[model samples]
Target: MIKLYIKQAFYQLRENRLISLVSIIGTALAICMIMVIVLVLEVRITDCVPEVNR
Candidate 1:
């Protein structure tokens, strides 16, 4: 059952290569944006803290 589902998914992905590519790119961009935001916030927070706390 799982194998059949996997096969179907693969076929669908192959059939809609452009769509799959777009989806992958969109997901990657979203992940990158979130990571950048988190890193920026972390840096700002650490910078605001006193050096004595480090």
Candidate 2:
């Protein structure tokens, strides 16, 4: 069941605190980096004219 999976995940995270912290941070950083890259590409594609407001 989903509840059992959630409980097991929490137990593992608690048992491996350092690894959990690292994994959480790494996932967050990767998400942030991807967001930044997408934002940059969007800006470049949309802001073709210098005087236009987006």
Candidate 3:
């Protein structure tokens, strides 16, 4: 099942500390990149109304 596959993946990640660290860092970077893109889009498309801005 999916649980078994996830458990095996975790076991392998733990067995290789360097790979695990890189994986963690890469995931974090990806999340940060997504957030940055969202912020940029919001800034670019936001309404410029006085009430909304205030």
Number of the top lDDT candidate: 2
| lDDT by residue (tens digit), candidate 1, 1-54 | 999999998998999999988998999999999999999998887766468665
Candidate 2 root-mean-square deviation in Å: 3.2
Judging by TM-score against the true structure, name the best candidate: 2
Better of 1 and 3 by lDDT: 3
What would the per-residue lDDT of candidate 2 be over residues 1-54, giving only the tens digit for each residue?
A: 999999999999999999999999999999999999999999888857787865
| Global Cα lDDT for candidate 2 | 0.95
In candidate 3, how many Å is residue 9 off?
A: 1.9
lDDT of 2 at 49: 73
Q: lDDT for every model?
A: 0.92, 0.95, 0.93
* Candidate 1: Cα lDDT at 25: 97
Regions more than 4 Å wrong, model 3: 51-54
Query: lDDT by residue for model 3 over 9-49, one digit each (tens)?
Result: 98988899899899899999999999999999998898867
Q: What is the number of backbone collisions in each predicted candidate, taken in the order shown?
A: 0, 0, 0
lDDT of 1 at 44: 84
Which residue pairs collide in model 3, if any? none
Ranking by TM-score: 2, 1, 3
52, model 1: CA deviation in Å?
1.5
